[model samples]
Target: MKEITIDYALRATWQAVARMYNEEAKQFESTMAVGFTLLSIDPKTGTPSTALGPKMGMEATSLSRILKSIEEKGLIERKPNPADGRGVLIHLTDFGLEKRKDSKDVVMRFNEIVKQAVEAEKLQHFFEVTETINKLIADKKIYVKNTTNH
Candidate 1:
């Protein structure tokens, strides 16, 4: 018997969850990405494009394209900045807000089930580890990239 490395465990976990999401819901990835970030952002201020790009693991141009597509689909709208005439604020439309509600519910239930399935101590460990990783990525821009020969 061999001990499983944390990286292996995380990869397995992500793959399992991603597969489940793919099978259960179409657009799960994109919807959750926008929905979760929008939920975190202030509707009044919205998030600055400069801050949002790196925080969301997206490049500025890529993020812009995504926003444009989403806006065209009627999920979001851009508002002119009052303070800075050249700036624009990203905001969720009614449809986007509704999707956020649904996404939040699904995520909450999924988290609850995971909590029940995992032992308390182990779950706490996972929480700490994930939080550490998230903070590292968010605050320090550190990402663990795996490069392997195919």
Candidate 2:
């Protein structure tokens, strides 16, 4: 039998999930990226434009595109950051807040459905394992043997 790797499984599962969300998003003329971006931003105070990319694990160019689309849709407004003149804060408009709530509901529904289908212990372990994997990669321990700098 052929062996399946963790990376392949993660990528495949994520692709499926993204496709599912994209299908749902079509009804609202949005994409998975936009929905996720909406949820990631702070609805009340606003989020820093610089911070959103890292926070969402998104590349600057891709995030810039999404932000541009979101802004063009009248969902968000970029304002001068009072704390930093050079930085901008991305804030949700009233319409954006409404859409954000909808986005939140979609995410909550997905979680609730998964929770209902899976055992709590299994879910917890899944999270723990994913976290451990993330930590391993973030700390560069996974590639330690290959890197001379380590």
Candidate 3:
């Protein structure tokens, strides 16, 4: 049998999960992806696409296209900045707000189901593992190359 290293194990887990969610929970998946990526921005201070693209690990052109599609869907709004004519800011529409709330509820229910399946003692460890993985990939320091290139 082939050895299953940490990367392989993690990749298999993520692939299986991606397939499951892609098949059974596409709406929830997209909402979760968009929400986490977008909501990371401060509500009081809007962020430009250039700043957002790097943080979300998205290519600038791809993120722009996604933003345009979502905006056309009426889930988000984009506005030109008065401070800088070339600058644009992103914000959620009322529809987007309602969708986000619904998405949050769905995720909470899903979490409850997962918690039920896993042992209580292991639940905290699950969170710890999740945080560790996030720190490894999502930390700005780890992916500083993107920012420096921009």
Q: What does candidate 1's lDDT look like per residue over 1-150, in tens digits?
A: 299987788899888876655454465545445555556545556665556676777777878777777778777788886777887777777877776676677778788998899999998898899999878877756755557767
The model with the greatest lDDT is 2
Ranking by lDDT: 2, 1, 3
TM-score for each model: 0.71, 0.94, 0.64
Ranking by TM-score: 2, 1, 3
Error of 2 at 70 (Å): 1.0
lDDT of each: 0.70, 0.92, 0.68
Q: Candidate 1 has what TM-score?
A: 0.71
Q: State model 3's lDDT.
A: 0.68
Query: RMSD in Å for candidate 2, one decimal?
Result: 1.9
Q: On residues 1-150, what C-alpha lDDT tens digit does candidate 2 reach at each position?
A: 399999999999999999988898888888888999999999989999999999999999999999999999999999999999999999999988988888888888999999999999999999999999999999988887654555
Local lDDT at 34 for model 2: 91
Comparing candidate 1 with candidate 2, which one achieves the higher TM-score?
Answer: 2
Q: What's the residue-level lDDT of 47 in candidate 1? A: 61
Off by over 4 Å in 3: 24-46, 81-86, 130-150
Instruction: Please provide the root mean square deviation of candidate 1 (C-alpha atoms, Å).
Output: 5.8
Query: Least lDDT summed over 10 consecutive residues: which range in candidate 3?
Result: 36-45
